[model samples]
Target chain A: MAARAARFNQQVLIDTTPLPDSIPKVKEIGATSAPLLSAAFFIGARCKPYNDDYMMCKTEANGRGELECMKEGRRVTRCAASVIADVNTHCLSEFRKHWMCLENWNQQLWQCRRFERDLNKCVFENLKLEKVIPGAPADEIPVHLRKRQIYAHSYANM
Target chain B: MPQDMPPVGGYEPIQYKRNLPARGFRPAYYLLAVAGIMTYGFYKYGKGVRELNELGREKMWSRIHLIPALQAEEDRDQVRRMLADKARERELLGAETKVYHSDRFVRPTFAVVPENTTD
Candidate 1:
């Protein structure tokens, strides 16, 4: 039986060992892709500084940044996870609606603009985290704020 | 041919011409209309592509910004495992032995999972 199981076992040794007691523990964010994408802008809005710091640490540490930047990394994780938690708490229905729409629409933002609007508004109002597409054209409205979506799967949402 | 005669105006001048007016727009007008439609379609297509590209950019940057933190998390677990394995090896063998031929530092990305069940 063990031989058969071993023959069939596909699990690679991506170890699950936790950080030791000397290192401060940070809980991993468990949200999957759709939910994460739905909350990504807000996470960026709230965690930009921490994220930049972590990236800087990684860049400065050369290849060894992976080990050297754990502290900055933990901060970034906590900030992002906190943003997700706050959005989950304050805008559960809107968040669900947007991500579910995202899941249904091949994760296309165009298809779920209405639900995203609701989520963006909710996150901004409740969590004070605004979704601004960085480096967007200044002369025109951002693509996300457009009233018409030419490529949407459904126009009713628009 | 039973003396068939012209009933009215010599059978309307034999009625050879297809007098039915051509339907729809004239060729030039229709071509212009089609060209207009295609141009508009291409314009809209361009806009959609541009929008999609911008969205892709946003998604990419988001992931890029996310890498450091996520990498750090994985590295922490890896370092912990390496330390734990080293401690265990020391306890079992009374001293640490090199597992690699080189003296240079090389981080192993994975380990062989120990099998506990006896076949």
Candidate 2:
């Protein structure tokens, strides 16, 4: 029975052995990370010369009379206002996408860490039980462990 | 004949004839009129006083009720700020990593020892 219990303990230890690289490290996304890289590429592709007429007017008015300066200022102000509005709209849209991505990443990381912790805890508990089994009282053995012992005995009989 | 009717003793000419009655009222009628006017005045004055009292009470109650509500609103704002700060702290500490354990049963002493021990 001692040998049998030792064998069962060994099996439990083997089953509860920690996996290599068990805990997943938190992932940090740098500037060169996929999400940021893709966002940059998307922005570069979507961006265009939005106020060509205003630019032309300013270029034509450069180093000219007072009337030209006034004209250039008006064109610049109008163009700036429109560009600001357009940028704000684009930023709002992109912000929502970025927020969702960050939220999803955070959730995934949380779940992964929780799973790793649970697995570690289970392994630790099994190790503790195996270490304590030799001095454990015969009648005081827990039902779950007793059931495992019974299963082992029956298997040995088979 | 055109004769001069000039009596030596009473030479009086009756010129005006009174047709309307006297303008003075009887005592009972005058008293009733005066009482009616006084009753109307008193009714108006009493109604005005009651309405003013009601308005004053309403204003006082409104002020009494408003102060607590405003104070409660301020207290709620403070509580909201406190909760916001706590939430910020939790966020910074990564609340998801927190462990929750409930230990219900006391672990058996023998279960924690080896059977090979003499004791």
Candidate 3:
């Protein structure tokens, strides 16, 4: 009876009734495990920069660098590129670099609220995960999942 | 007797009178001159008021925008000075200070001068 109750609790936890509103309609309709995993990954990446201390620290440092040296302002562009590359490579070192780039970007954004707004607008408008990531395709993924991924990429640099 | 009576009857008293010169359209001429002066005065005053108002508006606009820019510039200068002082202190202590670039948002062309250090 104890084993049966544990199994029931497990089943209850896995029940899909209380899904978030932000999750796309397509993800809900098809109800495939792959789409769910992808959505989770996208959300995780978007929220990563905000929560990670290392990324925040690096972002602050990068903001300082931009303030000090005008020439080094291009460092921001390079850092952003590096972050995208890291996402593609999926290497641990690349991941660390990606986080650092995000940290820098966030620092700059915080310093200038206008920059933050502009960056957010750009990400929201131009986010194409399938185009940025070679293997991914827009049609295969749910719309909310794509949005989450875009938000993640956008904030990743911040 | 007839001659005395005729002289008495014919004699009459003559009074002296002086004739003044006519002043033609004096009041009309004075009115026209005053009107012309008044019209010129109003035009000049209106023009002056308009120019003054424009200048005041321009000044107000400049003040509104200039204050913030001046404050930011002063803050930046102060920060630079403080950094310079810190660099001097490090030099006096013979410490190796790492120059960390601040990622503050400013124009892309501005360059900050680093403080002088011995080591």
Candidate topping DockQ: 1
Q: For residues A21-95, what per-residue lDDT tens digits would candidate 3 score against the true structure?
A: 332111111212222122222222342333233233435666343224322222322333333443434433433
TM-score of each prediction = 0.77, 0.22, 0.28
Q: TM-score per model for chain B alone?
A: 0.74, 0.40, 0.49
Ranking by lDDT: 1, 3, 2
lDDT of 1 at A151: 76
Q: iRMS of every model, one decimal?
A: 3.8, 35.2, 27.7
Candidate 3 lDDT over B21-65, as tens digits, reads 867778889899999999999998885565444334433432332
Candidate 2 chain B least-lDDT 10 residues: B110-119
Clashes of each: 0, 5, 15
Model 3 chain A lDDT-worst window of ten? A23-32
Q: Which stretches of candidate 1 lie over 4 Å from their true place?
A: A1-6, A10-16, B1-31, B99-103, B109-119
What C-alpha lDDT, on a 0 to 100 scale, does residue A14 get in candidate 3? 23
Best by lDDT: 1
Model 2: residues >4 Å from true position, as ranges? A1-158, B1-13, B16-19, B23-35, B62-66, B78-119
The residue pairs found clashing in candidate 2 are A134-B114, A134-B115, A135-B113, A135-B114, A135-B115
CAPRI-style class, candidate 1:
acceptable
Q: After superposition, how far is residue B73 of candidate 2 from its true place, in Å?
A: 2.5
Q: After superposition, how far is residue B16 of candidate 2 from its true place, in Å?
A: 4.1
In Å, residue B63's CA in model 2 sits off its true spot by 4.8
